[model samples]
Target: MPHSNSPMTEVLVAADCWRNEPDAEAVIQRAITAAAGNVDADVAGADLAIMLTDDAGIRTLNGNWRGIDKPTNVLSFPALQPTGARSDDDAPHMLGDIAIAYETMRREADDEGKPFDHHLSHLAVHGFLHLIGYDHESDADAGAMEALEQEILAQLGIPDPYGNREGMD
Candidate 1:
């Protein structure tokens, strides 16, 4: 648990559709808060940015940063570490940025037969975990990360995202 004096994590959301889908920002923020709470480390005072964009936007970013020409549902860019030691009075740590592709997310939800909001929340949690240094490149690492995601999603009243999948088993 974070110290009582620690500030709450600040979530800055940027999305053109947020006004139309009023609950989108709230869902993203809730996922971030829940995941941070469940993690072992204290990221209570961290700041993160979430950008909601279209598939084309994300595809371009993926190409530019990762050399992949496809659009992903979500992408996380962790903040670069600062060199040397500094005083503890600096501003809250900027955890990094997360971007979600609206079309990709919606398509995935439809394909998976899951609610759109739930799927969005899952992606938000996934992206935040990535920002906090979680990866799924190996079997052990993926299992551990999936367990954490299941726990956090359960707390948010969502069912296990990996259960009953065709190829996941």
Candidate 2:
């Protein structure tokens, strides 16, 4: 639903890292751009913020926002209204924020035996989808969301994240 004349989306990334990776910001920006392009909505004029932080930072945020005291890989805070309605035009559409935990993500990649970069891309796509109202609270919803993630990742030359895990005990 992107308008033909829509402007380019803006991505702002901030890394608050204790153990940082080279080119992390650039990688995240690429992932966000790719994910945004795949979405149905016209996000050409939207602005997205991504924060690369460690487990402690994300754990604090999770506690404050969702009352969870532990850290997760990624957390998305959507700015669009609950009804999916856009705000006023004067205000550039801020598509919420995505926070990623480095330790958790790296550990997960090691555990899964996947490349760190590829896993990071998957998480970025997953978080971007959440910003656009995608969820997996149910089996059907999970399938749809995972399918979209797979499609997006494929376009980015990344393998299916759930390929080996799916249908497993």
Candidate 3:
């Protein structure tokens, strides 16, 4: 949060199905900002993208990138640089790109008995953590990441997303 600002996040709605959540962009922005602050990551002037797409759109990305054939709720593609200094260059250093699936996220929200925005916020925060090098690939790593996610979301008035569940994909 250099200059007391978060990353320059671009929320792109690439699918018509995402229209179902008119506040998707706002929710994602808020969640990402909060996550950056909580993690003390100085991402100001860094560029990131949040793609709001449907299952099919995300599936293609997953297949191409992760060698997976199915869609997931959220996927984060972290760039080479985590954050960068203010520069006069035309493009700021990229932090990462996060893609979220509308149908999958909606289904998860309903199935988990959580509000759509709550689930959305969690996913956004989770993805942001990944962009900043947080991961749950191991038991200890998962605990630390999950704990931070809970703290960040709680500050946004969102309940503990892992209260009733074992984990998220």
Among these predictions, the greatest lDDT belongs to 3
In candidate 2, where is summed lDDT lowest over 10 consecutive residues? 1-10
Which residue pairs clash within candidate 1?
none
Candidate 1 per-residue C-alpha lDDT over 1-169 given as tens digits, one digit per residue, 9 for 90 to 100:
3333232444444546545567887788777778877887657666778888878889998999999999999999998866767568976677888889888898899998999889989999999889888999999999999999999999999999888678886
- lDDT, candidate 3, 1-169, per-residue tens: 2235588899999999988789988888889888878876778778999999999999999999999999999999999853545458557778889999999999999999999999999999999999989999999999999999999999999999989867654
| Model 2 Cα lDDT, one tens digit per residue, 12-122 | 444455235777765666777777777787667777777788888899999999999999999999885545555575667667888888899999999999998899899
Preferred candidate (TM-score higher): 1 or 3: 3
Stretches of candidate 1 above 4 Å error?
1-19, 83-86
List the candidates ranked by lDDT, beginning with the highest. Answer: 3, 1, 2
Residue 23, candidate 2: how far off, in angstroms?
Answer: 1.6
Best by TM-score: 3
Cα TM-score per model: 0.88, 0.84, 0.91
Candidate 2 residue runs with Cα over 4 Å from true position: 1-19, 82-89
RMSD, every candidate, angstroms: 2.7, 3.7, 3.2
